[model samples]
Target: MLRYAATRILFLALGLLVASALIFATLRILPGDVAQMIAGTEGTPAQVERIRSDLGLDRPVAAQYLEWIGGVLTGDLGTSMLTRASVAGELAAKAQVTIPLGALSLVIALAFALPLGVVSAVRHRTRTGTAIGVVSQLLAAVPVVWAGLMFVVLFAVLLGWLPAQGFPRAGWQDPVGAIRALILPAVTIGIVEGAML
Candidate 1:
């Protein structure tokens, strides 16, 4: 079991390396100069060249890839080209919302799926069981984005029970508002996930 686990870990690392390389290669081949974009239309040629030099875009492809991949492995996600902000910091900020939303979604999915799943199993071929099965199938078939939009229309627009978008500016400091904001989105994700469960 220990050996098997070690082998699996090795494969996971290898897979990640390959995937990262492919992604880097794809981005590198895409049209448009990153420095040019950052400098904008009015930027002089010398200014653009300086921007490229500052970003090390003047380096060989291999050297750039190695530097990027090294930074990633070291938890240094580097700076955003446009904003020049730390990518890691941005990701951490986003995680504040994403993590709670995911946890709430899981709770909702289990709360919904467990009881109904048991009921459907217990009733087997009965009319109620069949109906539940059909409903579950339909719910599962709905795209998650579409479900979110419909939920926004019903719960946020028509009924005005929840905010359609944006988290509380005060974050968890405003607990009630934060949870309220998440409800529609969580329900949209949870219900779809529940159907699959």
Candidate 2:
């Protein structure tokens, strides 16, 4: 089991590396100049060129990739393209929503999914087992966004129990409100993920 786990982890790391590489390569190949876009329509050639140089867009793709890889290794995710804000800071702020939602969803999913899975497997020959299996399959087929939207429609739109969009501006400061705000989204992601699990 340990060996299997290690192998899985290694494969997951490999997949992440490949995916990051693909993202970088795709961004490099995209049309139009990012520097020009940033410099804007009224900007002259010299200004655009300056912006490009400042952004290190003048560097070779290989050099840029190496720099990016080094920054990522050192926990420097670079700056936001539009806001000029620290990418890491933005990610950290965003984590308030993602982290709690993910953690809660995982817990909710596991707490319910495990037992359902076990029962379904155990009673495979029984009518109840067949019903459970069908339900699980049906849930697994539903998309995450659809589930989230349904939660919003039911809880936020219809019942007005939770906010439909946007996370708390104060983040986790108000613990009660934060949890309540996240519950719908968490349940949305959790239910779909748990069912798929």
Candidate 3:
């Protein structure tokens, strides 16, 4: 199990690196100036030039990429152009919400998919298995955003049972309150897996 985990981790890291390289290349190849994006259209020529130079946008793309990657290695993602704050800091703040949502989402997906997959495999020739497989395929076909919206309409708006969007912390003073807030979102994601299976 430990060896399998190490292999998975290695592959996951390589996947992430490849994805990041693709994203970086896409950003570089896209038709737009990063300097112009950072300094708005209304800025004076002198100001724009200064900003461009400051951001190293004046440098060759390869050089700029190396510098950016170097900053990332040193734990500095640079500043947000709009916020004028550290990008890493903003990410850290936002991650609190996003990370839990991601973790909860993964747990729910696995919990739903694993059992359904096992049942479907075991009951391969049974009518119940065929039905489950069809439903799973249909669920997989539906977009997550659409499923989330439907869930909000049904439980949050129509039934008034759960909160719609913002997530409450998992360890909120009242565990029940946190559960109430998360259950609907969890169900929405879980149902997608269940349907897909």
Candidate 4:
């Protein structure tokens, strides 16, 4: 089992590396200059050139990719062009909100979906089971952004039941207040997970 798990891990890592490389190549293949795009149209030629040089965009594609992968290995994702802030830092901050919301939503999804799916499978011909299957399929078809915005409108805007956004830190007087902020986003993600399950 241990060896099997290790082999699976290695294969998954390899697949991810391959997928990343393919995506990088695809982006390069697309029209438009990436450096120029980063520099923006308002930037002068000198500014764009400087930005390209700063990003090592003058290097060959393979060299650039190698440098990028090396930097990623060293936990350097480069800076955000607009904010001039470390992308890794921004990601870490976002992850604080996103990770917990994802975990909670996944728990909610499993809590509902597993038993529901089992019931649907067992009582395949029953009206209630068919309804569950239909609802799941319909939910699976709904766009995530649409569902998120709808929840925001319903819970935060119209009903005034939950706060719309931003999380309270664990050190706050009401540490659990973050979940109130998280409710809509959690349900939005949970709906998709439940449908897929």
**Backbone clashes, each candidate:** 0, 0, 2, 0
Off by over 4 Å in 3: 1-22, 168-181
Q: What lDDT would each prediction earn against the true structure?
A: 0.93, 0.86, 0.79, 0.84
Count of backbone collisions in candidate 2: 0
Give the local distance difference test score of model 3: 0.79
On TM-score, the candidate that comes out on top is 1
For 68-87, candidate 2 gives per-residue lDDT tens digits of 98899898999966678999
In candidate 4, where is summed lDDT lowest over 10 consecutive residues? 166-175
TM-score for all models, in order of appearance: 0.95, 0.86, 0.75, 0.75
Estimate the TM-score for candidate 4. Answer: 0.75
Candidate 2 all-Cα RMSD: 2.8
Candidate 4 Cα RMSD after full superposition onto the native fold (Å): 3.5
Query: Between which residue pairs do clashes occur in model 2?
Result: none
Predicted candidate 4 versus true structure: per-residue lDDT over 43-78, tens digit per residue: 889988888788676778788777777888898997
Candidate 3 — which pairs collide? Answer: 136-195, 136-196
Ranking by TM-score: 1, 2, 4, 3
> Which candidate wins on lDDT?
1
C-alpha lDDT of residue 58 in model 1: 92
In model 3, how many backbone clashes occur?
Answer: 2
